[model samples]
Target chain A: EAAVTQSPRNKVAVTGGKVTLSCNQTNNHNNMYWYRQDTGHGLRLIHYSYGAGSTEKGDIPDGYKASRPSQENFSLILELATPSQTSVYFCASGDAGRSSYEQYFGPGTRLTVL
Target chain B: AQSVTQPDARVTVSEGASLQLRCKYSYSGTPYLFWYVQYPRQGLQLLLKYYSGDPVVQGVNGFEAEFIKSNSSFHLRKASVHWSDSAVYFCAVSVGSTGNYKYVFGAGTRLKVIA
Candidate 1:
């Protein structure tokens, strides 16, 4: 089955520390996305990539950076972790050319910045 | 700008009862609407989507959604909901001429199914 897996299913980081959340997709899809879920906001897009070496900012990209080094891998980087950045992060893969279709999601990584 | 709205923050229904979750969208051109469900502590999963063609689209778990172009609404409905059907539902809209587009999601509606 098509799958998107994220590393560190749960993580707790100290404030001001650096954190990296990794994601890998076995479907080899061209589109990869990073989203953060929180109460009352649902899932908010943080960053997305059309393909390898192409990362784009989404609606909320203030404190996050994304990297898509290859078609099957995408990573979300937090240069400096903050309490506000703590949330459940999800990685998804899909076809960018067909945006009207569904995007498969990973289990999600729950991060808590103290 | 494209936006989605799910007015109710929460809804409670008894098992085996009919269910409906409201969703509305705002877009200039023809919009691509979708409904996704996320169970507790799980990732979001696609329930149904509306692009064109038939207004009513059937999805998994006996869930279906109808696209009302006039009202810019794509409401999800189920004939009978089970206990496992309880989840948070999200409505999203994609705006753009081509199929490749970014989706804007609503705050979401949490549904509770009673036994």
Candidate 2:
């Protein structure tokens, strides 16, 4: 079955610390995305990549960076963690061409910046 | 640009009762609409989607949604909701990816199915 896995299901980091959340997908999809879910806001896009080595900013990309080294791997990087950045983050993969359809989501990672 | 609105923030229904969740979207052109369900402490899963052809799209767990172009609405319905149906439902719009198209999600509606 298609799979999207995220590392560090839960993490607590000190403020100003750098954190990296990793994601891997076996779907072989060309598009990968990062989104943050917060109370009342649902989920907002942070960054996305059309293919390996092509990352793009999303609606809420400030303070967040994304890397897609290969079709099956994508990573979200927090240069400097902040309390406000603590939230549940999800990774997803999908097709980017016209045939692009539904996205398959990962289990998600919960981060805490104290 | 595309946007979605889920007017109701929460809804409660008794087990075996019928339920409907409203979702409205705004986009200049035709869009691909989808409904996702997120169970407690889990990731979001696609329940149903609508691109074209049929207005009513059937989904898993006896859930279906109808697309009303006139109102730009795609409302999800279930003939009989089970206790396990309690989850958060999100409505999203696909704005196309030619120019960094992004999926815009609604605030989401939390459903509570009373046993």
Candidate 3:
């Protein structure tokens, strides 16, 4: 029951528009993440991947940019969007050989930069 | 420099009542705790996790959590609560290792279940 799927969901850019947020995982889990849930700053890791092409840089990675061309897909790039990059954006999938690494989420994308 | 503290941002129980949501962590070693549950737009799930011997772990629905390494704390429990259990409650901490782990979240705890 670990299926992470996200795309579009809700968006409305305009600052410099180039937004793109999409993630897909069918349990193949090899680690993949990109978070951004403000409101007191709860979730913040901005990019992560450890399979297919690799890409890592968490702890609020600047304006954001990431892509893992394989291993079930993972992408989060906002080339030039602004308005503080809006908010709510999450996509996770984990399987560090499992020992309770626990992670498998995707049901968010609500961005809104204007 | 790992951190996670959920010093009660908001909590209000009622229906059947009985719940505790609080977490703290500074990380020095032996840490890998988690307890998530976000249900508004949805995105976080997994209501229990603690690496190492049992310190009282049990999750999903009934929920439960307790791992106090000399009070670094990892609180989250429930005895009855219902209102769909309200929402928002996160507390995570997973320092680096094996595939480069690093998850430190905590600024959540917004449950409101009244009758």
| Predicted model with the maximum TM-score | 2
lDDT, candidate 3, B49-90, per-residue tens: 988898989988898898989989999999999999899999
Q: Considering the two chains of model 2, state its CAPRI-style docking category.
A: medium
Q: What tens-digit string does per-residue lDDT give for candidate 3 at A31-76?
A: 8889999998789899999787999999889988899999889999
Output the worst ten-in-a-row residue range by lDDT, candidate 2 chain B: B94-103
Candidate order by decreasing lDDT: 2, 3, 1
Per-residue CA lDDT of model 1 for B27-92, tens digit only, reads 998777889999988898999888789999999989999999889899999999999988999998
**2 or 3: which has the higher lDDT?**
2
Give the clashing pairs for model 3.
none
User: What DockQ does each candidate score versus the true complex, computed on alpha carbons?
Assistant: 0.64, 0.61, 0.29
- Which of the two candidates, 2 or 3, achieves a greater TM-score against the reference? 2
Q: Which stretches of candidate 3 lie over 4 Å from their true place?
A: A1-16, A20-33, A36-64, A67-76, A79-87, A90-110, B1-13, B19-33, B37-49, B57-63, B66-76, B80-85, B89-99, B102-112
Question: Which one wins by TM-score: 1 or 3?
Answer: 1
Question: Over 4 Å off in model 1, which ranges?
Answer: A96-100, B97-100
How much lDDT does each candidate structure score? 0.89, 0.92, 0.89
Candidates, ranked, DockQ: 1, 2, 3
Q: Which residue pairs in candidate 1 collide?
A: none
Candidate 2's C-alpha runs over 4 A off are A96-100, B98-100
Error of 3 at B99 (Å): 4.5
